[model samples]
Target: MQNDWEWFNNNPEIKKLMQHTATQGYYFILYYMYYVSSASSVYAGLAFGAPIMDMILPLNETREKIPSFPTNYGIDGEKYFILLGIHGFIVNAMAMAWLWTTDAFIIMMVYHCSSLFNIVGVLLQQLNMKNCNYDEQYEKKIITEAIIVHKYAIEFAEFIEKSVTKVYGFIFMVNMIMMSITGFYAVLNFEKRKSEAIRMALFTVSQGIHLFLNTIPSQCIINSSESVFHAVYNCKWDELSIKSKNLLNIMLTRSSRPYTLTAGKFYPVNFENFGNIIKTSLSYLTVLNSMQ
Candidate 1:
């Protein structure tokens, strides 16, 4: 990650943002632990009290096939509960660890990618400084530097899309489906066990937050890329030689094309698309409610 943006190593502001983002990602993991613990307690209760129902996890087949942890409740009730508690803790911890790691990675990629793109806009603005009374040679040098930075920014954007988009996309879809199903079940079982339903509510909210957090940064990338057009157009093109004007025009043309981060190239990760996802999920939830 550091190597991807090595050009900005000396930049204090960029460094600060990167540090803040990393710290924030870790904080998210800590917050997620609370939810995982709550959900785990609920699942453990189901596993112990209603082993035949298999509501919490698909463990019925495995439980029946494998002589797993002590399930002979009549023979060893307390021992079974003790081992089950330990098993639940371990399983929950491992699942949450995997989830939290993925969340942190996505947060890092989205936040840093957005920041890097915005930094490119700042560089573009620098290229069109009206106050500078430099000679043509100096102006050309400034333009060249800006062009190099802009190219790197585009390359980094491509790298992020190709590497992160599909994985993030799949995760997003799965989370959406889970949120909907969990929400439906929570509503259906609310009166039976309010506490358990509340845990499901928390899970649904966290999933929503994860989706929104990723979506906002993607919109930031789009907005920053669009801003480049204004930055390039504001240059004093008439004052420069035809060659300089031509170069600025090329930059303007490039900036005019919106650069966006997408999920599988099917769902554009922006505010508009996010709203659509919510709307579609709610529609499904409505159908589920009617069936129930």
Candidate 2:
């Protein structure tokens, strides 16, 4: 992993990619934080009859709005409510931190793996026989490095697949359900409860974004892997020595099969599948609305 990090750090193109990904990740986290805070405020308002804006202020009113414990527990005093509020706030903060950290980790892995494939593609595309000093040795070295990086990328992606398949699968299923239910509710309450409908709509959109974050990087890996074949084919391989030609052939064969990330070892995670998931969710939402 350290070697891989070194390789990534040394590559200017990969560095740019990482920078762009980091910027996007930053905004994603900000959006998540906003959503969580807004949802928490709305929940507090519903639970304790506090004004939503007032809930944003850390004061006695907010403390009073903390979720009520059982009266039988003998901890319902005003002083205890302050402690309860602090404890609840800490717990929520921890849970949100864990959630975002796990998501960011998964996204970072996927982006790195995709970037490796892209780097290999760039290397293959840069292969040139027309250069005055080009030789079989140079060709062999470049192709070998590309092949090695390609292999590393495949291994990394497989590791990611093995590690996150169950988690992604579960999230995928839950997101689908959440989207369907929330979308239905959003539409159902649009006339009667505008604020609640907007909240439901935002929740549905959040689920969609989460699914996109998972699948889009997987699609990038697929696209980058496929680019390898095109890069190899477009390169001046015919001018190479027989041994170099053989190496190109090996790479061609290997690159022909694009690596993929899967959910539950069942669905290939990609833009196409992402669209299908949305369609299926909407279909379910329609059915649910009709049943209601």
Candidate 3:
């Protein structure tokens, strides 16, 4: 067991990725883009993300840059502090990348599920409408191929999402609980030391904001997955199958929110309750639209 552990610990590829993501574990959290996250696996194996990016189009385009701690300083204490700071960022980057992979997979699975059910329903309905003697092999073949693609996509997406969600949830819970203890202590100490309370609040609030934003995509995935079944019941029989497939794909792939999380760069969140930051702006837009 010791030798096995030593082998893994010494492995270059294994050491390249983060073992876990913790708030106190690392010092800074990078705004990890989804595609960048999945590409980490590729990087860990092949040292590049180009080939993987060809297959996935992650909605997040915000490239968050982190300033690393300077390792060149001469003093031992300064070097130690710099090393610690840089380690935190390295851990944060790995965690953020995993979080992103989960988000992208969740979105893709939902789209495929939605398309699958709608196509299935349409095909079944068509089967019922056709005469027993009429030839339906070509139509059935096309529909079967489409359903296979969707089913596999949905399965693959959901599997990846669930695995990542569970891992992230555990990491998040640990961070919150640890911070909460610190926060409680800080609140008590607030009477004597205001700065400590402020510092604790900053960290706690940042975690809260990150967790809440993370949950949004998960909920959206659930909503998208259910939509697949909804498409089945609302089929139009007279439409050509290929044309219908294209329309259904578009409808299924589209998320309810036109402005993705990345759009927040334009709207800017300077408030509590992360969702409300977007909600307030959306409400204003609604009113503007009503006036127009």
Candidate 4:
């Protein structure tokens, strides 16, 4: 009736005929939409990637071992591999828990894991930058070892990226398109369409972006395939005269392979815009949190 009065006051035609029923009529739509999008399978897809792996690699192999390793990074490559296996197992177990139940406990575990990953990833990234010796020493380490290290990383990144796009991306794309049409009806029926929380509306899209962003670093580090150098490093000590080591060093030091040996083996770590993208995302999340 108030809507009818408002109509009567504002527009002479329908003002007396009908009040705007839209606002009060269609409010439930938005609430339902929020619940469906934010709480469903969309969140699960993005959470599956491993953060501990990102931090584990450099910390264990580079920081933990050779002489005086830091508490954070692994001391030696062997310890690093072990930690990698353990972290990987934990992530897998969490995944298994999700398949069985969407229990709050499971979701919390995922959230905690992702947080830990983010923290460790950032620290490992900084630690790697500090450890100049890693590169210099890797320059001395066997080419075969270097190739395996690079392969393990690249395969891991590719697998995670592919899974994300294939699974979550598809689900949310349908959800978003459907919701958009629903939104159109919603706007048409309501006199004053209360804006759906923009942050909530874009929740599915954000997960897609998050997956792409997290995968970038792993992709970047794996783009090297120095294989001939692999053979040089694989040479038996008995087969290696000191002269051979000298020759091998010269060959490997100067030689490098583009990860796939194809023209476009893109490395996210090397990408000029990588760091800025991360900062921009964190900034956006901060702004959203403040708005809430």
Candidate order by TM-score, decreasing, is: 2, 1, 3, 4
Model 2 misplaced stretches (Cα beyond 4 Å): 7-92
lDDT of 3 by residue, 1-292 (tens): 1332354366443323212212211222234353344433322322112223434744355222212322444555332543454455566577766665665555444333333333334443543354554354544564565456446535644454545545555644455455555456446657765645555555455555555655554444444445444544354434436655554555446422221222222321122334563354335434544553
- TM-scores for all candidates: the values are 0.73, 0.76, 0.41, 0.26
Candidate 3's C-alpha runs over 4 A off are 1-142, 237-292
Better of 1 and 4 by TM-score: 1
> Order the candidates by lDDT, highest first — what do you get?
2, 1, 3, 4
Please list all clashing residue pairs in model 3, or write none if there are none: 114-228
C-alpha RMSD for every candidate: 7.1, 5.3, 18.5, 31.1
lDDT of 4 at 59: 41
Using TM-score as the measure, name the better of candidate 1 and candidate 3.
1
Q: Which digits, one per residue and each the tens of the lDDT, describe model 2 over residues 193-239?
A: 66667767876887797788678667867887888888888877667
TM-score winner between candidates 2 and 4:
2
Instruction: Please provide, for model 1 over 1-292, each residue's C-alpha lDDT reduced to its tens digit, 9 standing for 90 to 100.
Output: 6784576778776566556655655665566656556655555544454344445666636332111232554555544654655665676667767876776666566556656555655555554566556567776776787778677777767777787788778977997788789789788878986656766676677677767766765776687677667778876676677777888888888988877788887777888888887777778778898998
Q: Give the TM-score of candidate 4.
A: 0.26
**Model 3: how far is 90 from its true place, Å?**
8.6
Instruction: Give the winner by TM-score.
Output: 2
